[model samples]
Target: MSIKNTIKNWVLCSALLAALPITVTAGNKAEIGVVKDFKVTSQLASRDQAVRMFEGEFFRDPYIYLGPDDYYYLTGTRRHHLSGGSKKDWTSEGVELWRSKDLSSWELLAVPRRLGDLSWVDGLKAHSDEVGKGNARVWAPEIHFINDKWVIVHTTSVRKAMLYVADKAEGPYVETELSTTIDHKHDPSFFHDDDGKVYLTHRVDTVVEMTPDFNELTDNEFKVKPANRKMGHEGLYLTKVNDRYVIFGTAWSTDKIGRGSYNMYYATATDIRGPYSDRRYMGRFLGHGTPFQDREGQWWTTAFQNGKTMDFNTITKAKGLEKKKYTVFKDGIYLVPLELTVKSDGDVFFTPLDSRLVQPGPEEVQKF
Candidate 1:
């Protein structure tokens, strides 16, 4: 089948599923109006299928930050509850540190810090409102353990991303006083390279060098967008496979809202900021995800299927992208195995596993 046809069929299946009458199982209550689609193929059935880590927790922009002690720390944008607040107000409400030695089980470590607690919250809010992108409220956050300190790089409704630091993973993290900044930044991604250098990818797929101290930016910044792409990049993610660096980011078509589509585009480079190859599309229905490695050194992606707010059929026709099979799953935290293959012609693409598994496991000594 042509790639376009595959994508078309996938979107149609999703629409059919959405049109079905909502059903409730005995004990599992569907949150956010979504029910888990249990009709997957037998080959995809997981051996250990009892994983549901995000149950009852707010879910959006799923991220698993691997800590220094070999534990996985998870967080996401919460549903907004503030009156007259933007969409991400809930994210700023407070952060709950979900810690686990494995992906299956999780426990909350109370490091709750509200957005109002940040000293610059008022100033940032005012600036974001002035810019007219108030909905960007606490959009996406990326946390890293750097230089023996826990650091969070997050963007608010404002035009720039801010840096916060604490002695341990749990905080009262204070904002880092920086001498340099990237204006109008969103979707902060912190990638620490194997050589001990850390790089940041933000709005527009721009990569910049950051000092290990997390105090300032170095004199380097460049957009890694492939010349063939029409839209800019957000939700920047980088991971090294073998000796090559795989860079991926989320992009949306701007023709219309819900009818529009979002997907991940990627390019490869040997160096962090590079002469990257042309862009290629991954699962057409995927958006705003991160590819992480487990303790076993296997590559897995924590990606969510985009919700029904917009459809992708029109976007595919408009964008001239290849027809590809769409895997329509419910929007939630998914743990899918990944296989990276370099095409005979030297093109690199990734194939994700069908089985969705959430492994279980716990909290140790407080790191921060």
Candidate 2:
């Protein structure tokens, strides 16, 4: 897909974000609202079947942020009331949190801060067009331990991205002074540098620095993009890999929303604000998953079921992407091992340890 077409599709996707991503036809072609009829072989389970196996853990744009005290905090866009909620419930309640010493077992924390409890409630209401009509749902909530405090940044379907801070990860959290600056950013996340500068990266390719007190933000002009093109549609995430700064973004394989597989692409640079390198394929169907390391230093990335699929053999035509590496799973969080290596030149080589997740699909638009 050309850059112009990609941008065109993005405009449509941004508006429909509060609705579940779905396709109309099911046959050989799977792009946007179109999917070729495919079969769910005995070895493969449908998306609905996969959701059942999760036992209420189903989430979208899942995040695993390792915090202080040897605990990794888990969070994402969970059902508002924890059951029977729409996947695209923009009116869903506020953030949910879980903590684990080992990723194998998780302990649900009490709701730190409900949507109504947000400190900037009145301001957010004045800003959102959906107020009183049931629309302000939270998505992609990420908590970071910065400056010895737990800071939370989340985006709502109503186009308000706000921040909250608490003394602890599980909090009676309160809104920050910066919360009033709701300028329509989505999938906002934090990157704390080694020297202690906290940067918020969002809006596809923009980054901004936060004041030490967390009360305000610098000019929102810093941008990070693949060497050649803009980063993927959304889910812009940043982390330091060794000495290199690795940034990841999510997109559909065809570079157009609703077509092909959901996937991740990444780039690396020596500087946090940088002339980054060309985009590289991270994994097919791994869009929006968070990358982190285990207690023993083994790396893994979070994966979830965002779409349904049948066996490739059932796919009469997948545009040659059927032959590419792939993995099918349900709508819950799973950690796939990562093979991360840094070269002598300081560029990072990051790929899934599982061979099935190594390449972009044939329908992928951008050539890395």
Candidate 3:
């Protein structure tokens, strides 16, 4: 194709997208737009500034886990999936995974678990077309390497969660009996403690011990609430740092006030189930992002276009933000550099190293 014709095609495509609604709704709920192309007109951020990644895929609550084989595995909310953007996210047929040696380039590994893989999901689907059309949907899918096998955890639009076990990282994942135990679950996460205990979290704070085989949720279920406040609305995650337990959750910048910038907040505790300290800011517009480490041991947290993503300059400027587009890329995932700091008091906290991402915005309801 000639350069002139290629440019013409780009212009035509942009106009078509602009003519469409921001969200293609089904039933009565809105679903996040899926990715058909990862390419952008310009790089949202420089390589040195932030490790921004692109692919022909749409993702949310982005998760990347370092597997036992030493490869990084990634997954996310693929709600509408490949149904040409008509179906809703929760009704996604199943889970999709990708792998990479380095964060920049990724290869699609497999759609290991389709909606039909587990017969139980059918039992949960609403009798009516509550979700427009399609089976129960999956959200916030997570992959973990635990007990010498692969375990996948995800929540559904039906307000339940699932646990699947597979022999390989990418696999013909099978349903586990534990799925029946996790009811009213949302944004579930996995954690393997230093002493070898396996834990799963849901509803932003509630936790349950899991058997070593990842098949059963033991009788011990409890909540790990923060001392200062509830950890926002959804997208709860877990990790450990320096013998302390750190939990992260997503919420709007205006607290209970909705429709503001989606952001991340975290709290630390000495014990697994804790009376955690007050929540502190992780970064602006990083809601539901997964904090991870590259092969070089540098820390990074995932970020994506959720309503309005802020550039480094705009995220800190905090004036008339509502009027600003506050973003460039409308799809794909991002890696924001993070500094993990330990205070003299033995508390571990996170700070975004990207200058535009470091500070909380003016819309933040909490003082911290």
Provide C-alpha RMSD values for all models, in order: 12.2, 9.7, 9.9
1 or 3: which has the higher lDDT? Answer: 3
Show where candidate 1 strays beyond 4 Å. Answer: 1-58, 80-91, 132-136, 179-183, 230-232, 253-261, 309-327, 342-348, 355-368
TM-score of each: 0.69, 0.80, 0.79
Number of the candidate with higher lDDT, 1 or 2 = 2
Indicate the residue-level lDDT of 346 in model 2.
73
Full ranking by TM-score: 2, 3, 1
Q: Higher TM-score: candidate 2 or 3?
A: 2
What would the per-residue lDDT of candidate 2 be over residues 184-203, giving only the tens digit for each residue? 67788888888978788786
lDDT score for candidate 1 against the true structure = 0.53
Model 1 residue 134 CA deviation in Å: 8.3
Instruction: Give the per-residue lDDT of model 1 (tens digit) for 237-282.
Output: 7767656677786654331222334455677777666667676555
For candidate 2, the TM-score is 0.80
